[model samples]
Target: MWKLNPRALKYLNEVARFGSLRKVAAHLNVDVSAISRQLAQLEEELGTAVGMRSGQGFVLTQVGEELVALFRQQKASEAAALSRIEALQSLKRGRVSIAVGEGFIADLISAPLQAFMARYPGIQISVEMAGANEATRLVKEDRVDLALVYAPSPDAELYSHVVTRQPLELITPPGHPLTRLAPLSIRQISGYPLALIDQQFGMGQLVSLVEELEHIRFEPQLRTNSVAVLKNFVLSGMGVTFMPGLTVHSEIKQGRIACVPVPHPVLAGASAHIVSHKGRELTVSAEALINHLHDGMLFFN
Candidate 1:
């Protein structure tokens, strides 16, 4: 016979992740002795040593790994069950956390988020703006229920849906010289002062790839992580910046900026995707949010 206790499972899981009882206790804001005692009690009940001291810190035994895996599976199953229960009562009560790339956050949430919340007023929603890599990491770590990112790598742990290709564009102040060029090549665009996204943002890899493929290095007038700052620089006629259409769609429509397609080989294949964790069933609220995103993407393009 096996007894399930949430407290025991929580302690074990934290210990497995932190690799030290003291660290886990600190993270949980509990006394180290209490965590040690609880862990010892868990081991006694299970009749096995779950963790062993190593040179660096605690290492989980085989039994511990199996127990942790089972605990995760059970936790996921319980969450799914709760979702079903909530659906029976009403679809209005649930929460979904979404991590989105900064550039697409406005377009991604502008129409769809309002619609979803309007339909289900009781549902709670949280959206965090992050770079593509950080957004993918959040989804993989289950820190967020879903992720919307540009050019994310294929992840085995994620199920991608609602994919869309967004071509890069050269954004400039109105009546800029580059606007005369319908499609500008990388070499041609390099002639002007440029404001580029910094390496800290995930798009730096794309820039690096473009540099390698085109064999050209740009002497940027400015490099920043904020899209707004880049837009301001271009608006002020300081320099031109490259960005996806979604980032500057409104400005282009209002004639505050002009955009020419950047027909670079490296940028032709850039895409945006909505992804969720693989192998785990999504809650009804999460599923509803995904449906809204899918609908939003149709118009986003």
Candidate 2:
């Protein structure tokens, strides 16, 4: 008998990741003693210590490292198998999971993804709103079949199926004094009350990089990870924010918000991407939906 327990493997991976049994227990909403007992049984079965605690945190043994790698591959393969089985339905039935950055949600629901749902009502779709890092992580972990990200960090295990230029712009309430400047400079933007996204998001990261390169900084009145909050900050005439125009396209069209170009070369060249695991084959439904998003969304267009 193989004597392998997927549940034990799952607990081991979480312990390795979090580096503490108590922390993993809290995260998994289980008792710490339960995790310990499971791990003890695992060690008994394998007849080896998989990990050890140190001053820093838990460190996996060489054997444990290899086992984790194998476990990850097994999970990725299982995801692929599910995708293949979903393909057997010919798009009439299947579930497609997508992780999207909060900044892209406005555009995603309005046209691109909604159109896909209409076209294939039989297909089940799950959309998770996450920050840039979380979105990529979800794809990398095979928890999501696809991710829509802006200014994604390069990853060897991730592939970009669609990349479109989505320049970061200065957004303000309609007729705000800054709108007159059209393409504004960072210094000029800083002169106003600034409400910026935190470093967890792509726009915030880009702005921080520019500040570092230019040896300057802005004292933002507010900082957050929520796109809705940023938009509300601008719409309330409280302050200005930096975001892609497409993120607030409907508001701009309604003449409630004004999106002015930011002339910085880095901001001007920013792009959004459709990302997926490198070697995983997407189902027919997943593939078709990606195509729909590319063609139907203003974010891509």
Candidate 3:
């Protein structure tokens, strides 16, 4: 039978988290040699190498990935147990980390994050802004408790909740001729100068798919990975862009931009989702925040 020590598990999981033994050692307030010793012992006992040293740093083996996942489950169980104990004493304390797209911060995440923090001052929260695919990756890697992003293709490792479907919208500077139109089509919009988000992002992928299906190509006047920069391009009257309403709800309300829903058959099918690791029990802090998100997303619509 293989026996695991708590300290060894912590060290291994931290190494996976930071991708550095030195960083893990510093975080755990232990000597660097201690981490190495325990890691060596762990692999020796398990009859497999958890990680191998490389020129750049430590890289987890296939076994190491499985072990790390098990460790995350263990940590989640510990958190759930602690939540039970805390409830008996009327105390709540834990950290909740989220991975979300940058566009979600202003409209979808901000209010709920603030409310959750205010309600549970003892909880610690961290948010990482990333692209939709990056957000999904973060959740899968156990780097974050939850993710808010455009619907990623189904993955068995993830569970999606709090879903919302919104058509992609054509965004333009105030008083652009397209604004006067009731609804817009990809073919119609492609005729104008275009500013496009990069394909690494979900929005970009959606637009690219439509272009390919329609047998048309958009020669963008500006192309960028940054949503803020793309918005700026539109703001400066550089070119029209396509984005979901949730991304630019504030701007539309303030009359700084105009958003007309895309009439493309596929654009109407896009959606947003809140996601977490499948089959993992959430910590009290994470559960609370997810509840807040579910409620607050009503306004995001």
Query: Best candidate, lDDT-wise?
Result: 2
Question: What TM-score against the true fold does each predicted structure earn?
Answer: 0.85, 0.85, 0.85
Q: Once superposed on the true structure, which residue ranges of model 3 sit more than 4 Å away at CA?
A: 14-36, 51-61, 89-92, 180-183, 298-301
lDDT of 1 by residue, 177-200 (tens): 888886677888889999888664
Candidate 3 lDDT, 173-196, residue by residue in tens: 988888777666666787788898
Arrange candidates by lDDT, highest first: which order? 2, 3, 1
Better of 1 and 2 by lDDT: 2
In order, the Cα lDDT scores of the candidates are 0.79, 0.85, 0.82
TM-score of 1: 0.85
lDDT of 2 at 298: 79
Provide the global lDDT of candidate 3 against the true structure. 0.82
What does the lDDT come to for candidate 1?
A: 0.79
